[model samples]
Target: MKETVFLTGAGSGIGKAIAKKLSADGYDLVLIGRRLNKLQETATEINRPSECLELDLSLGSQIVTDTVKSWIQDHSENQVIGLVNNAGQFLRSPFGDDQDDWDLLFQVNLMGPVNLTRALWPHFQKNREGRIVNISSNLGQTPVAGTSAYSALKAALDNFTKCLALEGGAFNIRVNSVAPGLVDTPIHDFHQKDDSGSLQLKAALHGMHPLSRMGQAEDIAGAVSYFLNPNNSWTTGAILNVDGGLSLTSKDP
Candidate 1:
């Protein structure tokens, strides 16, 4: 039987890309997202058997845990062997923004992964093998203006990845993160309202990287596949920067 991977935020962007890559590589997928229709759409594209679940990760810890448990129970035959915490909310706001915004950001970007990982940890422990790949951002390591909340949360996530790796080492559960630079995805649509603005913004972002180009979702997905592969089994507690050399540039204006 093929191993299964539970991926959060599988409806779009990096999450969707990861789903397609993993499916092609012969893993059954349990795709989770807030939009049922979008999740179903993604499921249809994959050749491997997949299940879609509608979940709002930011809702609460109990709800997230309960929902995941239910899925595990239902898919007992597949035997989940991997998890990708790819779901995240990117809210660009100044430091003095409303407190509610801060709370929501943490809940979605941080707590959601924490809750789901905690819920699935026992299964990994029982199986004596598992892989967890977190979708982090370069912003987590390099501070950028107007993304205080997102940067902070991702920073915390990176640290959390290391901590989990240390704890799960004896159990053979590998935990790692992939931090990508600016990628061409709908996530940037909020800033680029028009074609002209998008073109300018794309140029500026591309200029920030030494590669002279922004990243594609497939670029990040490739790195994720590397970590997920059992052949690359010795690596853990590592943060792989799939940023097209963006981290090498100065963060100054």
Candidate 2:
């Protein structure tokens, strides 16, 4: 059976980096994302035996679960050994301004992963062997003011990781989470150019990390790879911080 890993958000930024790293490590892929074009680009870049699934996680449990279950059935030949719940939305709204965004965040960031993982549970249980890695955020552990909603959801995901680990242990499934710091991913809008203001902002963010630098996508990917590596099978129920000391700073991004 072909060893395969299903990865959500496998299109750009950190997800793309993770996809590339996993492909290099010899796992065939099932790239899932909201944008088919972007997912296709990632598949082309990796040039591995892979498939793409365009899915909107916020569409509710029935749609997400039904679609993922059907896809798993169709790709049964490729033994799915891992799942990376990396698809998430970031929100930054202060106080009263975030009511609507909170609803959206709960639906997308929290319920999305919840439903998707539930869909994969049966397959993993059947095999009695599987690994799951959640791409959480440093904000979950240490919240910044405007990121209240996002932080709460990520914090919830972290708890879910531990709970899943406890339940999955009987089936030989390991569940872990990687909480990344301020990585120079596409999420931030001001980083697109070398404008003076952007440069200044970067300098401040760098200072937030004791390492005196912003994290690269590869930095977070390395941590994810470590967890996914079969040699570390005994490790589970962990929430690792892959920050450049940014969590320690506890500064607002």
Most TM-score-accurate candidate:
1
lDDT of 2 at 231: 100
Question: Which runs of model 1 end up more than 4 angstroms from their true locations?
Answer: 194-196
| lDDT tens digits by residue: candidate 1, 133-251 | 99989999997898888898899999999999999999999999999998888888776766567777778888888888889999988998999999999999999999989888876
TM-scores of all predicted structures: 0.96, 0.96
* Model 1, residue pairs in steric clash: none
In model 2, which residue pairs have backbone atoms overlapping below 3 Å? none
Error of 2 at 243 (Å): 0.2
